[model samples]
Target: MKDSPSRPLYLAPYYIWIALFVIAPIALIFYFSFLDLTGAFTLENYQNFFSSVYLRMTLSSFWYAFLITLITILIAYPTAYWLTKTKHKQLWLLLIIIPSWINLLLKAYAFIGIFGLYGPANKLLQALGAGPLQILFTDFSFIFVSVYIFIPFMVLPIFNSLDKINPALIDASRDLGASSFTTFRRIIFPLAINGVKSGVQAVFIPALSLFVITRLIAGNKVITLGTAIEQQFLVTQNWGMGSTIAVFLILFMIIIMMLTGQKEKGGLYNGKTK
Candidate 1:
């Protein structure tokens, strides 16, 4: 199955792109992580990260990301399953995807109106005679916006996995006296777990690195790894510490991808490995 040496020539552009955009930037960040503010080699950057203040921020970033991923999975699994059963799947998927087409800033801005003091949330509560409740810049608002932004990343992968399922397997399960719920528990869910892994990978890693929504919605009360990285690099002009955070972030992402990778593929319920 070995190809001619020229075969790799077709991938020259891809290799170049990866070298210039991906590898080079990561190399620079790794190099900077080893240096201090004066461009001298030192371990201060690493020390600063393990310090209590920054360590807490790192944990908070992961905690919120976990919550976002959990909620997204709970909502996306059912929605994706429903979409598979719908007559107009494409239209429904488009509706789910349409919001992503809008700019992230614009979407955050739109939510600002909804969560503002005199906005729809307060208005609706007033109508219910429950009075206004503050949501803007709170932890609840932060989680809500994260889930809203990342739900599609979760749904699309699960939907693709579900749509790829074989109908005959379900029919055979029924003919063999398996109930719908039993069939799903034993057959459907295990097969679709690859998609769940993919969805979690897509949502959680980026959530760990996002600061914008936290900034606009959660304000100074919430400090994530992304916000801390931004502060070290931009606000504090501490590139070494920022690059250290960026390196660890990349490390965490790699760990997630490895954990999510499939050991095998199955498209039908034969209780067989192919």
Candidate 2:
């Protein structure tokens, strides 16, 4: 059969969009990574990225991203589980997601006030006789705000996964005398593993590249690779080093995607005898 003449026409815009937005920017970054500040080709940027300073920064970025992802999962999973059990599950989920619709900068600034010296957090502490503690510009605040921002992202995927579970399977587990923990560990979580993977991919990748939250919430005390890239490009005007970091960040993102990516195989059963 002959193909439709309009098929390629239909796809042209998509191809052009990918080329301009995705391919072109990456090619530019890769090209820039090999250049020095003077626009001369050099490997110095790559060499410098492997140095102790950048190595420490990279490790710190990974650490914070891991912590944020882990904490988000801990909080989001239980919340999602409860949401699934609610009488008005969609309404509850909507409430949870509503906060995420607010501008991230607005939320950050709001937290800045909430965590400030005389803010409600400190006021509560003082009321309890512990005195106002330094909450803003601290690791706790940074992680807290990041977790708050990412919870909805994590919850949605997990909730969808959990919601898709056949009630019969859960009932079967219960009928078999499995404890709630055992049922979750053996049945529910295994089925929802893909959703957890999706959530991890959604949360972890952005967490690694977080700069604004680190600056606004952590007061530049916690510098991720994204912050370093921002400094290189904007603050220091070193596009080469920034692109170098970006190239590696892209590589990291690819590796993480690969690690978390789902594999297609038999579902429930392969319909074959062993």
Q: Largest TM-score belongs to which candidate?
A: 2
How do all models score by TM-score? 0.89, 0.92
List runs of model 1 lying over 4 Å from the truth. 1-16, 263-274
Q: Candidate 1 has which clashing residue pairs, if any?
A: none
- Taking the tens digit of each residue's C-alpha lDDT, what string does model 1 give over 1-274? 2857556677899999999999999999999999998999999888988999878888989999899999999999999999999999989988887776678889899989999999999899899998888889999999999999888878877888888899898888999999999999988998788888888877888889888998899887788788888888989998999999999998988898788866654322211110
Q: How many steric clashes between backbone atoms does each model show?
A: 0, 0
lDDT of each: 0.86, 0.89
lDDT of 1 at 160: 80
